[model samples]
Structure formats: C-alpha cells, structure tokens
Target chain A: MPNTLILSIDAMGGDHGPSVVIPAVDIAARQLGDVRFLLHGDQAQIEAELAKAPAARAASEIRHADKAIAMDEKPAQAMRRGKGSSVWNAVEAVKDGQAAAAVSAGNTGALMAISMLVLRMAEGIKRPAIVASWPTMNGISAVLDVGANVESDAEQLVEFAIMGAAFHHAVHGSTKPTVGLLNVGSEEQKGHEEVREAHALLRANSFDFDYRGFVEGNDIAKGTVDVIVTDGFTGNVALKTAEGLARFFGNELRATFKSGPLAMLGAVFASGALGAMRKRMDPGAVNGGPLLGLNGIVVKSHGGADAPGYAAAIRVAADLARSDFTAEIDRNIRRLGAVVSESAASPAEGAAE
Target chain B: MPNTLILSIDAMGGDHGPSVVIPAVDIAARQLGDVRFLLHGDQAQIEAELAKAPAARAASEIRHADKAIAMDEKPAQAMRRGKGSSVWNAVEAVKDGQAAAAVSAGNTGALMAISMLVLRMAEGIKRPAIVASWPTMNGISAVLDVGANVESDAEQLVEFAIMGAAFHHAVHGSTKPTVGLLNVGSEEQKGHEEVREAHALLRANSFDFDYRGFVEGNDIAKGTVDVIVTDGFTGNVALKTAEGLARFFGNELRATFKSGPLAMLGAVFASGALGAMRKRMDPGAVNGGPLLGLNGIVVKSHGGADAPGYAAAIRVAADLARSDFTAEIDRNIRRLGAVVSESAASPAEGAAE
Candidate 1:
C-alpha cells in the first residue's frame, strides 16, 4: 500500500467557496491515491456539496469554520482578525503536522501574508517568493518572485534563484534545472546594480542547478532556461502583461473568424485543431502557483480556477510534499550563506594572516 | 501649393542600406505631399537605387558620407569615432535646420547617442526617451522610455509623461491625450517609492492631458490610456515580453491550422481574414520609435524593416515636423518647472514667515 498522505484545504476560499471546493476535491481524490483531505469550512455547506461527490465525502474530514475571509480583504486586516477562519485553519494544519501540505484559492495578498506568518521563512531565506509555471516552446519553465516582495536586493534575488530551482525540480521533475537571471539584456553589465551583483554571486558558486548568466524578457517564452529568476516587481508586470496580450489576441482572433460566412465555415472545419490549441494555452492546465521559501508547503491556486484547475493545484501540492523540496532549499540556502560569509571574511582573513 | 518639409535620411544604415531607403522614400513621396528627402550615404549607391524610383529621385538631394557606424558598435565608441558617418550626417542636417526631422533604421544606441550629442536635449528635459507606437484593441497608444533610461526618479517619470503626452498628440492626433504611469497595481500605494511619487505628482498637476493615475502592464494592449509612461527597464521588458508572446501565439496558431487536411482547407478559405489580422499585428505597420526630449525630431525604425516599414518611419518624421510637437512640449515643461519650484519653495517660505 502507498503511504497515506493528509492534505489540508481551505474549502471556504475562492469565488464559489464550498461549491467549487468540494467538487475540486472530488476530482483530486479520483486522480490521487491514498490521499485524505482535511476540509476546513462551513460544515453544512461542505456536507451539502460533498454528498453529491461520494468519493470526496469518503476521503475528507470536515472541520467546521464559521468565519471565511472575504476575497477583497486587506492582508493586514486578515492577519488581525483571521483566527478560526477556514483559510487560517487550513494553513495551521500543515504547521501542526496534521497535514503534509495545504492548498488554498483565496485573496493572493492575504494568502501570501498568512502563509508567511504561519509557516515562517525557511532558515537563511530573508524573503518569500511566489513561483509560477510558464508554458514555453520546449516545455514549462518556472518563474519566481512573481509578487511576494515588490523590491528585492541582490541577496534576495539569489535566494529566489535557489528556492525557484528547488521548487521546479520538485514539481516539474527536472533533476537539475538550468536557471537564468532576467535582465534587459543578456550582457553582464546591462541591468541595475542589484542584478549585476546577483549575477556575480551566481557565477561564483557551484550550486545543484546550472546558472546561465543573463536572459532578456523574450527568453522566457523561448525556453532559454528552466528557471527564470527576477525581482517580484518586474516578474509580476511580465506575467500580467503576457496574460493581457493573450486575451487581446484571443478576442481579435474570434472576431476575425466571425467576420464572414467563409471565415465561419473555415472555423467550423478547423474546430478540432483550434480546440487543441486552446487547451494548450488554457490557464487551467497549469493553475498552481506555489508560495516558495516558506517553512511548510502551501500552494495558491487561481481564485477563479475551475474544478480541474483546482485539482491541478492539488497535484502540485502533493508532488511538492512527496519530494525533498524543503531539504533542497535548506541545502542551497546554506551554501549561499557560506559563500556570502566567505567573501566577507576573505579580506579580513588575509589581513590577519 | 503645400509648404515643403525636408526629412534627413540615414541611407547607409540598417540591413539593406540604400536599396531599402531609396524605395522607402519613393513610397513616402507618393503618399505624402510637399516632402523632400536629404539622403546621407555613399552617393553612387544612393544614385543607383534612385534610378529605379523617379518620384524619390526628383524630391531627394544626396549628401554622401564616407563612413557608417556598425549596428553592434558600443555607444561610447560610436560617439568617439562617428563624426561624419551616415547617421551622424542625418541628425546634423536637422541640427543645422536643413531638415525638420531625421529618420534612421540603424543602430539604436549609436543613433540615440549621435542624436543626443548633436541636437542636445530640450531646454527643460533631463534625458531623452524613445517613444514606441503600441498597437492596442481600441487604437494605438504611445509608450515611452522603452530603452533610454534604465532607472528614473519621480521627476524623470513626470518628464516622460510630459514628453510622451506631447508625442502622442503630435503623431497620433490626439487633441487632448490621456496619460497613465505604468505600475504594479492601480492602488495608490502599490508600487515602489519612485512610481508612487510619480503617481502623486501626475495626479497633483493639471497638464495638457488627462492623467489616468496608474495602469498595470495588461492595460497597454487594452487601450486603457493614450500614453503609457514607464522607466526604460520595465518598459523594455514589457515590450519585449509582449512581442515574444505574440510570436509564440502566432506560431501555435499556424501549427494548429496546418495540423490536418481539414485544417489546411480551413486555412485556405480563411486566408483573407487571417491576412487582415496579420496586418493589424505587423510591427512594420507601426515601425517608428521617436527619440523624445531632443532639440529636433529623430525617428528610429526597426533594423530589419523592409521598404514599406522604412516608409512608415519616414511618414512619422514628416508628421512630427508638420505638427507643433516641440512647442507643445515647451509649454507643458515650463509649467512643470514652475510647479516643481513652487512645491520646493512652499516649506521654505512658510518657515521664514
């Protein structure tokens, strides 16, 4: 028999709350074996939905939570009065050792803030980062620090590199991912001081992953590297900008195909191929964005994710929990700390000698 | 008879040099009335290409230059040794008042460097910004500082807003353009100190355009504003990211349409609509990127632009020359100086009282 794994889920989060959560858990339960869920939400609502999903009812243990944080609530406000809330308890289960991982589809800012507070930063990590899976020409590459810290220094960027690579290995099954530092140009002297400094650091050390020097914004979709590391501000803008362009193109393409009867007939004949392309580009296919650099595993699904999308997020959480993701982070972060300290001590040690 | 406007051309620049430049001028001569060209390059090559285009030959005067800067040359190297190169002569014509504006499909760095060294910055402008005409759902919006300034202070960002707004008005014919500061979020306190400060300044001032406060990266293609002002670093990344995604989606769509026999037939029938959509998204259609904050106008076309694309850049230079772009900038910049000075003096005057 496979080892039984317990997963905590915030059933009162996201746009549809229990309605989406119960159905999503059912999908996840059907796909993943020997996995049990600790569902935290309103008992009546969760039970009403779980009754319709017999598999989900059999695998889930309900923990009644009367309070549910609003999707638009401020991070600080959520922190102050979020005790006993479904999202809060779901994360708490991971910290309490009752669950191997926690998954939630809720307010991004509040979820990140809560995850940081509950799990705390992993040893030697100054800041936490959110990592997104970007679909590329070759395959999916991981992009990190998407929106955790708006501003990051050289060391923080290095930390992101370490955590992002480890997370990619766990979720995407890359044994040793190749990482890249995002900049305006591929040249060493192209970007600002912090990026330059991070480049120097990444070049000096020999980590588990290969550190490709520098990559531009276009390199993200070109699949130039397995892990693309950047400060949260630039990464966030790039992510949202790509999403916006995709929407714009989709709308324009639809209008083009509907312009004339000939175009409409062409679209009908091309429906099979077009449907396949849409599936490849679908956001739901790769829905999970794991909050990296925290002490415990927590995945944040898109707030508007469907049942299948939420299930995809659950699979990500399960994969991360089964792998040595935390240990990998701890080892790399320790190496980084040593490198920084060694550089710091080199001049002083030379003087004494 | 219309008033004659002269445009200086870097005929020895870009991939095709005189062959593309002469044909492009021919196209422009047919489209725009009362526009004369001063071609700067090797006289023999310019004359050879001019033989094929009678309209351009009649309207053009060749100013032969012995040298041309290499596209990959460093900015400083070009500045040191680029005295009588084709790009240098092109800008010098504008500086000497022989040409109202200059156009180059050459080295962006060398051209910008030469333009800055020769024409110099405008009276109140600190640094020059390159403004790109971005294709949007509603129409085109002008995005500025795409790769000119790596980092911008709050004041420089405001300068971009003033220059960018004036530019949109000049080129796109927006009588009262709307401007937005590109930020991580629309919330007042979302971004870093500089963006926040820039937002505050834009909101406080009553300028020639309507200040739309802050816009995220996605708002660019959505046509949320007429002018989107950003620091060069963020703007460059965003521009490249969008272009990369566009290429990615285009490739995927083509692959989908060519996957099977039915799809191939559909592609044939829908070719007209697809061709029209392609034209809308073509980079050549909006090929010009004007270098703003200079004493005279200078537009940079894509290095690999064909004849028609090069002509588009020429048309942009012609439009700016005919419009009161410089005067509009001067009016708003003087107002900005007064506002900055007033704010700087308010506390001092109050303390003295």
Candidate 2:
C-alpha cells in the first residue's frame, strides 16, 4: 500500500470535542486502513476518550497541545497570542510536513489566519479562499470564499472563480467543471460593478474549465452548476442561509409528522424514504470544507460538528492527500501565471506584498 | 364594518394573466370581506375567468386595459411605450384615488419603474424602495431595496433603514421594530466604508425608532430583529437566497417521503405535522412586497406565483391600505427629516430631483 495519509486533527475543537472526535477518528481509521491521525489537544482528555478504543489508539498517535483557541477571539490577535493552541499546532504539523493535511473544528477565522500565517499562500495565489461543498439535487456543488476574505475586488473574484473550478475538479473528480458567478440574475450584464467587471475578466481568460455564465441564488441547491464563485460576503450569506433553511426544513418535517393521526400515519409510511433523504441532506456527510489555495492541506469542520462529522472531515482530508490536489493546483497556478504574463504586462513581481 | 380596502389588480401582468389573477381576486374578495378589487387587463380574458366566479364577480369590479407588458422588455422603455398596459392602468387607478392600493404579479422591474415614474416618491422621500418580508422562526422580518436603487451611499442606506422600520410597523404590526443594518458582522464598526458611515449616521439619530445596531446574514431568517436593512445589492441576494432555500426545502421534504413503502408509512404518520409546517413556510401565504415610500400604494408579487399566492398578495395590499400605512410612513418620514435637519443642515430642500 502507498504511505499512510497522515491527518492532524485538532481534537479540542467543536462542542463535543474528543468524545465525538475520538470515535469518529476510530471509525474513519477502521474504514480507511491507509489513513492515520495525529490527534492534537490536551493529552489527558484525548487519552480518556481513546481509552474506549484500544485498537484505534494503536492505529493512531497523539500530539498534545496545552492550549486551545476560543471561537470568539479575534483571528489575527489569537493567532499571534495562542502560540501553543491546538489549532495552531495542528496547522504547524502540515507546515513542517509532519502530516499531509490538517483538520480543525475550531474557530474558522483562527484556522484561516493560522493557515495563512504559517503555510502561506501557494504560488500564484493572490488570496486563499474557503471552499465548501453543499449537497444538491443532482450531486454536490462547491462554493468558494464562504467566509475567508470578506472584502475582495474584481481580480480577486476572478481568481476565486479559477481556484473554485480547480478545487471542484480536484476533489469531486469532475473533468471540466462548469463554473458560474452567483448573482441576483443570470443575465450577462447583471449584478454590481464588481460582478460585472469580474464577469468580463473571467470570460476573457482562457482557462480550460467551462465558465457557465451567471447563476441565481436558487440555482446553488438545485445543483445547476458544479462550481459557484462569489466574494466571501455573498458566499458566506448564501452558505449560512442554506444551513438555516435546512434546519428550518428539518424542524418543519418533524412538526408535520406530529400534527394528527392521519399525518402521523403518513409520516410512518414515509420514514424510510425520509431517512434516506435526511442522510443525503445531512451536513455531517458534507462536513469538511478545504481551505483552498493554501500551501498545505487544511480542512475546517463545522464548529458544532459531532464524531461522525469529524470522521467525514478526516475522509475529505485523506482524499485530498491521496489525489495530489496541491500539485494540480500548483500546476494550474503556473499555467495561469504564464497566460496572464503573456497577455498583460505582468504587474511588478513583488506587487502582492 | 369599515370602508372596503380597495386593491387594483393587474389581471394581465403575470405569466398566466387573468387565468390566475381573476380566480385569486375572487378568493381574496370572499375570504377578506372588507376588501374590493379593480381587475385591469384584457377585457375578454378577465371577463371569461370572472364569469366562472359568480360570487366574486358580484363583489369585485373589472377595469379594462388594452395592452400587457412582456417580461423581457426594458422596464422604462416598456412603461413608456405600453401606456395602456394593465400595470399602468392599475397604478393610474391608485393615483386617481379610485383604488386604495395597486398589486401586480408582473415584470418586477417594469412595476418598479412605472410605480416610480407615475406615482413618484413621497414628498420628503429621496427614493422609493421595494421592501419584501422574509419568513423567519421568530415571525417575519422586512428587508428593503431588494433591487430598487442598485448603487446607494451612506445617506441612502440610512434612509432605507428609516423607511424599512416604518414599513415593518405599518404592515407587519410590529411595535417598536428593532431595525438592524445588514453587514458582514454585528460590530458597529464593521462592513464597507459606506455601511460603516451609515452605521454612525443611524447611531447618531437614536430617537428614530428602535435602532438595534447591526445584524448578519444568518440573522435575517432567524428573525433576530424585526427590521433588517441593507442596500439593494445585498438585500436582493438575501431575499432571493431565502426564497430559493424555502423551495429547496419543500422539494427535499417531498422527495424524502416518497422514496419507498416504509418511508411512505412514515410520511403518512408525519402528514399532519408536515401540513402545519408547510402552512407556516408557504411562500403563497406571504406573497406581496410593498414598494414602500412611493406616493401611491403598489405591491409586487413573485413572478412564478399561482392563484392562491396571488390571493395572499391581494390580502397584504388590502391590509396595508386599511392600516393607514401611508399616513404612518409620512409621519415617520417627517419626524426623521426634522431630526436630520437638527443634527445636520438640511440638504438644500429638494436634493432628490
């Protein structure tokens, strides 16, 4: 077998912590034999949870970190202050090449800050974006910059589109992902000046991926497009809205079954089908979102995620490691750089700093 | 009981036209006994549908219009060219004092354009905003300028917040509505430069209703606050995203219950609860969005709405008319203008034109 895909997990993160993370990691390791985990957190808490799974303990190793990052702390300040935090330590493993990837269910802002501060952006990346895959009717559609960079210009949006397309292809195994800019309307000249200018830039580029015009808010869940690109502000709103609606729908479904006898009977008959649908729509199944365009692999799990959710996140990290996504992204970046350099007078090389 | 709330219905505006509009009018006229409708559209088509509803025919009146506006035409160009269109006639009825309010499930852009052109803004109002209500767990929250004025400055956003607050109170029956500025974060000092300045402006005028500081995307549907305010671009995205999720949730629920026999049984038992849930989440029940701050009453319905949905729009328009929303809005506008005048010098009286 190829060398094990080592994933560094921030066990102290999330509401459930090692109680959920330990079981989830055990389940994932058992299912994917080639995967091993470096659990980073307080050694005592992690060991107490892992004690239940002696076999998993033998399969995985623990890397203790004394401190943990609080969710509400300012991302930049916390990264500077929490030098020994589990999130920081987990990311450090990837930066030092101790692990192929890192997974955290801690503060998203902190994760993004530490990832950027430590591993830095990959070659040709103007800014790193957070990309999440949401389950859709057709399959799954990937939305980028959900909350990474809140304020982005037209160039950054275009770059996000390119990165999103590449990430979708790399992770989902799609040949030519159909990328679209999320907007109020699908017309050629809709949306604000940023979107309008970004549309022009994206259209002019000769990327191998298919730029499938613009998509509306409703199109994301319908799975109409494979990759949806937007500024972090809009993208974050769309993602959160989707999550909120899913919760609302789940509550509504539960309420529907409890109304009366006839309805209760109807629900009984629909339990199996409903269960399947629930599984498909389960956020846990689509738990992890890769922090794309980073130098090292880092995945951010939902803050409220449980053991099964953490396990799924580990699976996503392992899959990225196995697929050589970073290498592919690096190659595309260089290709993009060459194209950009030839067409336009390349901006001064040191412009990013 | 009270003077019937007169609502002019553009019977020829929607995709289905009189086929949907007439039946919906009839339903509203019967359900809401203290309401009357003036249906304006193709004489023959509307008459044909109205003939089917004997009771509604007796209650509601029809005013014929020779032409209808197509969805694809430019809003201004169409309104200018198609002077005798149903939308125009309906607005004319409202302006002429023959109808208390005008409601249309027509081309949204056309409706807004014509409403602004014909009715104009209220005397002290700078711009007319299209305000829509988002259904939330707490109740309902109003988001303004879904697509009224695309590019807005700090002053305009402050104006929107003021107008949106009045609207929530007038229509939603919200007392002391908590008005929030929709930003990327809840901090008073966050968001783009324009939003940041607007936040300061709103904070300075603390006497103007209950200003609840800032809110984010997730808060819109949670109904954390009563009135959520944002510029047209962000507001449009939030409104559309919420609508899309509602539809997606419905479809997912249906698919989940219909998968197999056991699932079917489960759905049967859950049917009553589901119906109650669906009732609460139904878009048709919350169909109309008033074009607030206009000199005359105008309500816009969703493009894809059906008869039942159209009926709800009529009810909303009637409710607004009966509640003296215009008078309430006018009072607040004057109050706000007085406060603004005191804080800063009045902007040369007629800066709006």
Assess every candidate by TM-score.
Answer: 0.96, 0.89
Model 1 lDDT tens row, B145-257: 88887778888999999989988998899999999998777877687877877777776679999999989888988999999999888888888877777667778878988
Candidate 1 clashing pairs, residues 3+ apart or interchain:
none
Error of 2 at A80 (Å): 2.3
* Model 2 docking grade: acceptable
| CAPRI-style grade of the A/B interface in model 1 | acceptable
Name the 10 consecutive residues with the lowest summed lDDT in model 2 chain B: B344-353
Question: Which residue segments of model 1 deviate by more than 4 Å?
Answer: A282-285, A345-353, B282-285, B345-353
Error of 2 at B321 (Å): 2.3
Instruction: State the DockQ of every prediction.
Output: 0.46, 0.38
lDDT of 2 by residue, B287-320 (tens): 7888887888898887778888888788778777
Angstrom error of the Cα, residue A232, model 1: value is 1.1
